[model samples]
Target: MGASDTAVAMSTKDSSEASLGATAAGPTPAAGTAALAIAQARVSQTDLTGLTLSGRYLVTRKVGQGGMGAVYEATHTLIGKRVAVKVLLEKYAQREAIVKRLKQEAQLASSIGNEHIIDITDFGNTDDGRTFVVMEFLEGESLAECLARETKLAEQRILRVGAQVASALAAAHAKGVVHRDIKPENVFLLKRKDQDFVKVVDFGISKSLRQSSEEEEAVRLTQTGMVLGTPLYMSPEQARGDEDLDHRVDVYALGIIMYEAASGRVPFSGANYLSVISQVLNEEPKPLRDIRPELSEEFEAIVAKAIAKNRNDRYASATEMLDDLNAVIEDPTHSTERAKITGPRRLLPKAPKIPRIAWAIGGAGIAVAAVTIIVALLMGSKAKKQLKNANANPPAARADAGVATVAPPDAGEMVPAVETIKLTIVTDPPGADIFREEELVGKSPQTVEFVKNNKEVNVTAQLPGMEGTTSINPLERKDGAEVKIRLKKLKGPPKVIIKKTGETGPQKQQGGTTSHTGGELGTNPFAGSGTVH
Candidate 1:
């Protein structure tokens, strides 16, 4: 009742629910509305329990009812075997035309000779003029019931059910019988051979392509101005009342069923039948992956093709669709999606053109420089996040240089508009506070990143009662690099040396490195040293 994406399931109590709209006989708006109304009102009102049919089978309680009629469980008096008897209501049974069509349905289904199809054993009219077709009494419930209980079928079960339905449909198509109505409600599921087995039912609106008999040739079953099939599963062509509908219609409907099984809902729905039909004719269904992204791309593609707007775009027939389903069932990895994306592709803008001379001279150096710059810029932005606590990462001295891996932009991966680099700060004797560009970052053993501008950045490490170290390593180095700092124990507490009034130059320490006057860390040796030449 909401919109196309909202699925409104039919009543699970119905064994077979069908929707009738415009048929090959071009339909007017009124006809579409009227047909849907009639289809919706197909509930059985009369109870025929305890009646003997054709003096052969004794009618029992009604099992389920649907758009066309009610199905009853009955037993043959002589054989004492139970069977399902589908009987037309008196109003429809008395109509010679409707009766002939029902008989044709039995003939068409029986002729298919597929095990997945319901087995129609007999078709006869009783003394009361009630027409019925008897078939094997299935002990399991319809797919509608299963979905109502479970919501969505498992993946393998979906494929299994789809394969079986396709097999049945292939057989029907080969026999020139096109099942115009295929939906969850019409598919019966039961345990057979210890596996989930499917039996396709409800051939009331089926159309036979071949005229194998005089009765079939003389009286066409499909009526004029009366389109028939379930609105939820109708193909676009069928919704349009196209006169030349073919087996692909069944293929499309089956795809919808499979889609429903995977997503637990139909792609289209509406408040009334006409609205649904309108969507079928005018709207494209949401992609199968949109609702359930985990579904394999290959599987989604198969369903997408089945429901293509153009009939030719769909599977040639149910057999063709069955082949793909079988392949998936046989080998889980078998898929067409890989072929769709085969070969290399670039996901970003092309890198700037580098001159041949530059590559010949220092290509690796240039690449490293770019990565470092990128890392530096990134670290600059994240500077505030770095823990300022001096002892954040208690550094442990290592016998060998600690190595850290820096990931550069992937090959063919688009480079961001801005490049960045990262520098890992690790110090010996641990717990030293680190400062980048004179700003407090986390303690040693931390990594800092920022945009790689050409400007030089100075790094400093500090520890109490020890001489801190500061160094400007390089503009850039090859991808994986580390900045290791070694701090020395202070000789004693700071010596407050008073400078003479005219003294200006820095007072050099005994070791050659000059410590800052504040007793934190020494500045870079190059600082304030002017005009060496």
Candidate 2:
């Protein structure tokens, strides 16, 4: 079968796909052939800082090195902006064919300016004939780093990460760009205030439609007898060396990434590259539930769809994967949709609640900056002169230079119908100490109110011996209206456990009943507990 057909077939099949490598009646190569071949293609490593490109970009530290080229972190002298530059070595730089393909990589990536895909700025070669491509420098860690740091990500966070990557892939596909290499190392996780953002990098091995149809059909970009990509992520068609590859290959690769992100394990792992390649062709990944039983059913179905062995059974595009992910986020209750497609009762074992650290880092710095800006604006307005020609009787100005004072409007008038609003905090347990913006307030099941004209307010609840804190967004409430908030208990530490009866586990409650269900768990510092359950 052709590459595209093989890729489609592998991606669309359900769980019935058979194993390919060891059972197939084919002659396999020597055990170390793949590694031996990889070892022979070594090019001498050179310092990236030695090369000067684009006049202003100075290469700094080396980020990665591959068979074809090496990547370096570079900074623009004038703008002080950082970027990643991939430099083809001097030995391969003289080959016109390789140089042409390398240039195409930069052009294709540059054509798509979407935020999910790595941003490419420019490409050029130096006087010494070493070619380099300039790309944006991502500030945060790679998905690989994140996975390693957390070991395994939270179910919601994994879905969020997948959705972002899917959006990037959709944009690239719309522009006829297919990311041939989609792995954790190539995926960047940018940290923000509320959540993490994802970006796909390294389109160097990607294929684009800019090439002629004839070239696209038969041209193999890899050098003679060279392995192009990481074995774990290669799609079946890519492993089989078929030339008619397309977007479906990317889908298959993304499936593997999602699998790893959710379960902390690759779907197909073998002793060698060929075995891994064969498994991609014939094997079915162990169901996600089997690996991480605590993951939600909706997420399992999403993983199943992405990992389908037939292209038709899987999502038609990355956009479709993103849609499913967003649907789960919008309604976690819709998880039952998986039971309809699969079997009944794949209840993801309840995930052990892990305490999220109270990360109130540098709040003071941000507050100070905001206050400075507001003070500066107030001072600036005070210097403006008032116009009073026709109306000569103007109000007296303040004696302070740069400061102006005005009398309150209608102070003598009666307070306009003082309206009363009620704000109530609802906790799982009926009563817990309440707080507002981290400051202790009252107890739960209590009502409070803000006067009209208050723009925003925060309400929090805390229980003794519980690491969890519940907060409410008082800004959502309108003036003179009641607001009811149901605060979901935050995970405390990792001390909570399941029991067969109605009684709680080892932890004790405040009233001495020893019921710990609604209370905080224990500490899981560094995410040492591999699986949540």
The numbered model that scores best in TM-score is 1
**Cα TM-score of candidate 1:** 0.54
Predicted structure 1: lDDT: 0.64
Off by over 4 Å in 2: 1-45, 217-219, 225-228, 330-533
Q: What value does the lDDT take at residue 273 in candidate 2?
A: 77
Task: Identify the candidate with maximal lDDT.
Answer: 1
What Cα-based lDDT does every candidate model obtain?
Answer: 0.64, 0.59
Tens-digit lDDT track of model 1 for 1-533: 22211211232222122223244445556565554544443422266576677777888889977656778999999999999899887678667767877887798889899999999999897554678899989998889899888888777678889999999999999988999999998899999787789999877768888755565433444456557788899998888878788899999999888888888988789999899999887566665655787876556656765775556546777887787777656444555342231111111332333211112134454565456445544675353123212113424534353422223334454323444444445565556766655455566554455344556556666688654555443344211123556677778873233444553533332112112212111101111111110
The residue-by-residue lDDT of candidate 2 on 452-493, one tens digit each, is: 333444554445554334333434442211122333545564
Clashes of each: 23, 18
* Model 1 root-mean-square deviation: 26.8
- Assess candidate 2 and give its lDDT: 0.59
